[model samples]
Target: MQKIAIIDYNMGNLHSVERAVSHAAAGNATVAITSDPDMILKADRVVFPGQGAARDCMRELETRGMAEVVREVIQTKPFLGICMGMQVLMQHSEENGGIECLGLYEGNVRYFGTVHQDIGVRLKIPQMGWNQVWQQMEHPLWKGIPDGARFYFVHSYYVEPQTPDLIAGSTEYGISYASAIARDNVFAIQAHPEKSADDGLKLLGNFVAWQP
Candidate 1:
C-alpha cells in the first residue's frame, strides 16, 4: 500500500481531496493537516491542494515551516498540486504584489491580463467553473484516462510549464493554459480532480497506483 499524504497547510479543499483518494481506494493514506516535515518526508506520495492567492499560499507554507519540506518532497516523492497548489510549485507568482514561490518548476503565475478580469462574472478571473483538459503527454498518472476529459477548475491564474514535454494536459480560458504538468517525481494538475467526476476519480486512482 502506498502511503499517500494530503498536505494540509491551511489551504483550500483538503477534505474533498482526501475523499477522492478514498474513492480511489488507496489502501494506505493520511491527510496531514499539520506542518510537520517528518510526516511529509515519510509519506510515499504527497498531494498539495490550494484555493487562494499564490502569495498567501507561499506565506502559509513558510509560516508553517513546510516550505523546505515541500521542496524536499518534490526532490524525493511523487507530488501532485491542485489549482493554486500548482502555481506555488513554480519559481514565482505575480499575485498579491508579486511573491517568490517554491521554484520547483521554472515558470511563474501571472494574471490573464486586460482580456480578463481579476475576479467577477463572465470569463471571470478566478475561473470558477468546469473545463475540459486535453491530454498532451503519456504518463502513468494519466493512465487509462481518455482525452478531452472535463475537470473542475477554479482559479484566476493558470500555469505555463517551462517546456512542452512537462505538460500533461491543457485547458482553454481566454487562452489555452497548462492544465496539468509532470516532471520526474513531480505531477501537478490545475484542475480539481476530486470534484471532476468519473474521469477525475480514474486520474486519482492512477496516481494511487503510480510508481515513479
Candidate 2:
C-alpha cells in the first residue's frame, strides 16, 4: 500500500486535511500526519498544507528543521501544497511586511488590496468564499473537475509564478492570478480542498490515484 504523509510543521489544519484525504483515499492508501523528516521522506506522496502568517510559518519550519526536508521531498515525490503551503513555495511573499520563502518556484506572493482599480470596486482583503477556478493547463489532478469549477478560498495573497507555463489554474478576485501551479511531480493550489465539498473531494481522489 502507498503511504502518504501530510507534513505537520504545526502550521496547518492537519486533522481536517487528514479526514479529507482519508475520505478521498477510500482505503486505497494510508495517510499519516507527521513532523519527522525521515518519515516524510519515506512516504510515497507528501501533502504540505499550511495556515497563518508567512513569517510565523517560516519560523516554525526553520525551527523544526523541516525546510530542507520539504525541499528534498518535493524534488522526488508526488507533492501537493495547499493555501499557505502554496504561497511559501514562491521565492518571497509580501505578507508579514515582506518575508523570504522556500524559493522552490520562481514567483512572489502579493496581497490583494482592499480595492481593485481595474474593476473599480471595493474588495475585501481576505477573499473568504467559494471562487471560480479556471483551468489554465491540462494536468492529471484536474481529471474529473470542470473547467470553471468553484473552490473554497480564504487568502489575502496570491502567487505570481515567474514562468507563466507553470500556472495550471487561474482565478479572478481583483485580477486573475495564478491559483494553482504544476511542474513535474509538484502540484499546488491556493485553496482549501478539504472545505470545498464534491469537486474538492474529486480533486483529492485524483491526487491519491495520480502517478505524477
Candidate 3:
C-alpha cells in the first residue's frame, strides 16, 4: 500500500486536511501527519498544508528544519500544497513585510489591495468564502472535477507564477490570480478542499490515485 505524508509545521486546519485526505484515500493508502523528515522522505506522496501568515509559516518551517525536506519532497514525489502552503512555494511574497519563499517555481505572492474591477464596488481582503476556480490546464488532479468548480477560499494573498503556462487554475476576486499551479509531480491550490464539500472531496480522491 502507498504511504502518504502530510508535512506538519503547526499550521491550522491540519486535522481537517488529514480527515479529508483519509476519506479520499478510501483504505487504498496509508496517511500520516508528521514533521519528521525521514517519514516524509519515506512516504510515497506528501501533502503540504498551511494556514496563517507567510512569515510565521516560514519561521516554523525553518525552526523545525523541515523547509529543506519540503524542498526535497516536491521534486521527487507527488506533492500537494494547500493555501499558505502554496504561497511559500513561490520566489517571494508581499506578505509579512516582504518575505523570501521556497522558489520551487518562478512566482511571487501578492496581496489584494484596493483592487476594483467594478467602480466603487470594493471586495474584502482575505477573500474569505467560496469562489469559482477556472481550470487553466489539464491534469490528473482535476480529473472528474468541472472546469469551473467552486472551492472554499480564505486568504489575503494570492500567487502569481512567472511562467503563465504553469497555472493550473485561477479565481477572480478583486482580480483574477493564479489560484492553482501544476508541474510534473507537484500540484498546489489556494482553496481548502477539506471545506469545499463534494468537489473538494473529489480533488482529494484524485490526488490519492494520481500517478504524476
Candidate 4:
C-alpha cells in the first residue's frame, strides 16, 4: 500500500483535507498527518496543505525545520501543494506587506485588488466561490478531469509564475492568472479540491492513483 504524508504545520483545518484525501484513497493507502521530517521523507508521496497567512506558514515551516525538508523532498517525491501550500512554493508573496516563501518555483503571490472587474460587476476579493480552470499544460494531475472544470476557491491572493511554462492551469477573475502549477514530480494548486464537490473529489482520486 502507498504511504502518503500530509505535512502538518498548524495552518488550517487539515481535517477536511484529511477526510477528502482519505475518501479518495479508500483504504488503499496509509494517510498520515505528520510534522516529523523523517516520516515525511519516508512517505511515498507528500502533501503540503495550508491556509491563513503566508508569514505564519513560512515561520512554522522554517522554525520547525520542515522548510529544508520540503526543499529536499521536492527533487525526488510526488509532492502535492494545496492553497497556502502552493503559495509557499513560490519565491515570494505580497501578503502581510511581503512574505518570502519556499521558492520552489520562481513566482510571486499577489492580492486581488479593486482594479479587478468582470462584466461590469466589481470582482470581490477572497473570490469566495467557484471558478472555471482552463488547462495551461498537460500534466498528470489533470488526468480524467475535463479542461475548464470549476474548482472551489477561497483566497484574496493569486500566483504569477515567472516561468510561464510551469503553469498547469489558469483562471480569470479580472484577468487570467495561474491557478495550478506543475513541474517534474511536483504539482500544486491554489484551489481547494476538498470543498469542490465531484470534480474536486475526482482530482483527489487522480492524485491518489497518479504514478507521476
User: Which candidate ranks first by TM-score, i.e. highest?
Assistant: 2
Once superposed on the true structure, which residue ranges of model 4 sit more than 4 Å away at CA?
Answer: 114-121
Expressed as tens digits, the lDDT of each residue in 80-126 for candidate 1 is 88888888888877788788888888886777763365444256567
Candidates 2 and 3 compared: the better one by lDDT is 2
Alpha-carbon local distance difference test for all models: 0.81, 0.93, 0.92, 0.89
TM-score of each predicted structure versus truth:
0.91, 0.97, 0.96, 0.95
**Highest-lDDT candidate:** 2
Candidates sorted by TM-score, best first: 2, 3, 4, 1
lDDT of 2 at 182: 94
Model 3 per-residue lDDT tens digits across residues 1-212: 99999998998778899999999999999999998999999999999999999999999999999999999988898999999989999999988889999888998898787354434567787799999999999999999999899999999888999999989999988678899999999999999999999999999999999987
How many residue pairs clash in all the candidates, one count each?
Answer: 1, 0, 0, 0
Cα-based lDDT at residue 149, candidate 2: 96
lDDT of 4 by residue, 1-212 (tens): 99999999888878899899999889999889999999999999988999999999999998899999999998998888999989999999999999988888888998887335333556777888899999988877788899999999989999999989999999988888999999888988999999999888888888888887
What is the alpha-carbon lDDT for the whole of candidate 4? 0.89
lDDT string, candidate 2, 92-200, tens digits: 9988889999999998998787236556777897999999999999999999899999999999889989999999999988788999999999999999999999999
TM-score (C-alpha, index-matched) for candidate 3: 0.96
Note the residue pairs that clash in candidate 1.
Answer: 126-155
Evaluation by TM-score, superior candidate among 1 and 2? 2
